[model samples]
Target: MACNGSYTVVIVPLQNSLYSSDALRFFHWLKKLRALEREKDSLWIGLQVLERTRFWYQHQLDQISQRNARVGTRELDEEEESWSCALRSSMQRVNGSLGSLLNNAYVCSAAPDEMDASDWCLRWTNAVLTQEVSQKNDRISILEFEKEILLQQRDGIHYF
Candidate 1:
């Protein structure tokens, strides 16, 4: 008995070829390095955002402290009053968005019996701003550490 069949033949590259394997490993290493670089860039951007936020908080804190200092037993002159009013208006805008820290809102609700409403509000706002600044500082530190680690990893891959 005789059997008739058609067979198709195709040639494929050897899986264990040294150059192909080396090229594959090189591409993989490049991909890892690129990922590490992107992570480092993101961390840098985060640090910058934290820095800007901290600066804004510091500016607000300074304004609040200045107002606290300027509030005294003696009444202000017209010029001083105008400046104080401007500062107060600016601070009010800040507080307005933060759930109205002034105008007898949260501060008055939680204030001690002896504390005046405005005084309590300023103190409360100052405390909150201070905490925000500290938290931003902590986050900046953490991002910096991560960026440093990412750099080291990227360098290792590059040298490998």
Candidate 2:
């Protein structure tokens, strides 16, 4: 007899056609194998999520760096310098946290039997994604405010 879900069972002839204790043990082992296969699949999925998140963070960092380079070296006012410092610090923290998450995912994938580790990976990924979304919303809001200010200025100039 063969079982599905990545398990194969072989039954050898034992006298006439009759059930045996050995067959029961094989069935139990097959069930256990299937459970392990499911766990392995979950672990694989967590690893893939971590890899994608890492790639996205890296790409964002690259974009920020390029933008900064284009801005060139101009003397920043105190307020601008403070804002720049805060943004740099935030980016560093994000990068460090992402690295830690990737490391945890790698370790968890190595030991798929650790259900707790897999759960932690899922939670961490969710938190990181939420934070990224919030940051993007803030950037969009800031851009919109700037656009409104520019439009108001144009209107005032045309009215003069």
lDDT of each: 0.58, 0.65
**For model 2, how does the per-residue alpha-carbon lDDT over 54-127 read when each residue is reduced to its tens digit?**
89779868976876886767644554555556567766876797788778865554433343546655765797
Q: Candidate 2: global Cα-lDDT?
A: 0.65
Give candidate 2 regions above 4 Å deviation: 1-20, 71-160
Roughly what TM-score does model 2 have, to 2 decimal places?
0.40
TM-score of each: 0.34, 0.40
Looking at candidate 2, what is the lDDT of residue 19? Answer: 59
Put down candidate 1 lDDT per residue, 63-100, tens digits, no spaces. 76876787795556654565555556655655565554
lDDT of 1 at 112: 32
